[model samples]
Target: MKVLSMILAGFVVGYAVSDIRPFDSLLSSTAEFGSPTTIVNGLTVLALTACLVSVALARSSARGVLVVAIGAVLVVVFRTVGMVTGMFGDWAGAVGAGALLGASAVLAGRHRAAQASLAVAAIGAGLLGTALDALLQADDGPVFVWDVAGAEDAVVPERAIVMVIAALGTALSLYQAHRDVALQSHETRRTLLVGLPLPIAAGVVSWFAGGHDSGDAVWLGALAGMAVLAVVAAFALPGRDGRVLLVLFASATIGSMGFAVEDSLQLAVSVALLVVGAGIGYRWPQLYVGLGGLLVVAGASLIEGYVALPSLSQFALPFVVAYALVSVLSTAPGSLAVALPALFTMSLPVTVFAASYQAGLSLSSDNAVATRTSEPDHLVLSLAGLVVVAVVTVACAVLMRRPTQNPAAR
Candidate 1:
């Protein structure tokens, strides 16, 4: 149930934040911004930020329900704006109704009254959004008659169902994190540091700065910058658990790969980055050493220009290896917590790739699929380079797990 709640929360958050709805056009048109799109985007940002801030405050030493309340208010305002400006149509009403249902669920949960109240507020916000959407598009306008025309037979709407699942998963994950998982002092700090901004900041910067030119220097420059950052982080924190650094590097690399793929680069930078990240994971046995090598590979790529790249297939190998390492070395909660943002970023390209594959199959066309690999040989070489990360993580986990006979160490 907790897992289901978490998954639902994730899905709700995703849907709320992204303008993926079919009716987004209407909402975008209604906002104070020239278009409804800007309104929706602004609202999403505000809501997401509020939620994240609230979560951060709750997790840290801050004592107050203010952050959570602020989050709830922001969500309500977001919805109210959408509805008042004709963005929601009849959807606004559904949001109210859904809030009632969600509130009931929250009260039933095991959390303290305050926590449960916050949970209820979140659910209310989600419900209100859902209801507002539903009301906006009702077949027979405003008559209160149940309209089944466009409705699915499923109890929960498809998108809502997905959000619920994600919320459940997230809740379960938090529960697990609160259980027995232990981390070394350094590892804990490293994990927290890496999790803070790398996931979102790198992504936003890359998205806005990316170029359309096939061999644009910006692409290579970003990769090089990432490499440098990794090296710096690794060296600055050269503890035995350098594997945490690799995990952080991998998350950043994954973000870049997603950006490159989403941009539809003919250069196949995604493959290269993935392979390089993987190789660091599998060999070297220390993040610092792996980072040094990564910097070299990226620097070489930047210097080599676009023409001398190798095959694309080599790129997938590193991701497979990196994920394997993540699955094996990290405890369940740590792995899930660390993986969420990375996987979320990775999903964008995976979705695009899957869609392209499906389209290719549907047309029964013989047109060769666009190559994601920059070059075959480079991919292979990079994949080999990824082994360092695996070695480092495994070795660290093993050493960390061993009993210390030395009283000083203990």
Candidate 2:
């Protein structure tokens, strides 16, 4: 399970690097430094993968062949990342590389970590990659198009702070997961490997959405219906049920992929939603809290349709949906207040800081960026939404304070 997770992280980092530096050559195609971002990220993934494979090799000889094969595969992935261009070629390359990684991980079998170090490797590298990307971002503040040049700013501190919190948060979650698995809880699966297909499909779908018209009513209806099914799957199925998770991921991925696909402004926001869903599954504690978190989202969406809330704020909807699955079936109501910070941070706070830092650094502090996200209404509605969220969270917390209010906990 842990090995697969690590491999998944490595694969994602590889993909991110490819996206970050799609072109092989720099300006005029004469620069000696060819896609510095891609080269660096590729090296990072290679180093991590090699480290993981080395550990596995130390435990057994059978892994040696697997190690060689994986090394060869990584070489191929790195070489082709820039060699390939355009939508079709990129899609094929990504899918092919991901499949190779998946096959290698599966063939290698699971490794026993002396101290749950495997999960830490997977979780840590994944977290660090995002932080590095955020920290290294240029082009004003936290605007999402992170091309590989920028002087650090105030956002750096906030990202660093979040990185610390993420590390501790993941550690706690892993510990609880270990306990659950030790107790033979059904919620703990052998691996989330079965769930990997959703992201691959999502990446492709998101890319497809990015280039085309998704404004047609048919696409909207299809996506909305998928989302409804995804919510239904959350309520009707078990926590670790593969089929249900597949539905949930597909819905969350494609639904958000399609919803924000039409608007160029929503591209970053859409990517953010997909990342949250992919990175953080419906893990413990999050299983029920999603319901309360989503209540705020649904309300906000309705209001946004009329009042024109910033599109970045709309990104929060999927995170809440992913976090706040319909729990009435498996668990009772949960405290919304508990999930408020997480929901907010993962969604709006991220958007705000991205916009804020951009506004503060690149654009005039007095004048907003030309982006729709920079509109004045973003601040006003966002804070009002947060206040409303806080009030709702408190009410739910008070109500769910009783054990009967949260059957899932029992």
- Candidate with top TM-score is 1
After aligning candidate 1 to the native by TM-score, how far in Å is the CA of 46 from where it should be? 9.6
lDDT of 2 by residue, 1-410 (tens): 43343334333333333232322322233322222322222222322233233323323333343444344444333334333344333343334333333323323232222111222222223323443444345344454332222232212333333333433343333333332221101111112221222222222322222222332333333333433332333333223322223222332331221233333344455446534643454234343355445445545554665785675435665455433332221221011111111111111111111222243554546544432211223334333344434433443344344443211221
Error of 1 at 21 (Å): 12
On the 0 to 100 scale, the lDDT of residue 242 in model 1 is 34
Off by over 4 Å in 2: 1-69, 72-77, 80-92, 100-216, 224-240, 243-286, 308-410
lDDT of 1 by residue, 169-218 (tens): 54444344333322121123433444444444444433322322213244
Any residue pairs clashing in model 2, and if so which?
A: 141-357, 141-358, 290-323, 290-324, 291-324
TM-score of each: 0.37, 0.36
Best by lDDT: 1
User: Candidate 2: minimum summed lDDT over ten consecutive residues — where?
Assistant: 332-341
Give me the overall lDDT of model 2. 0.32
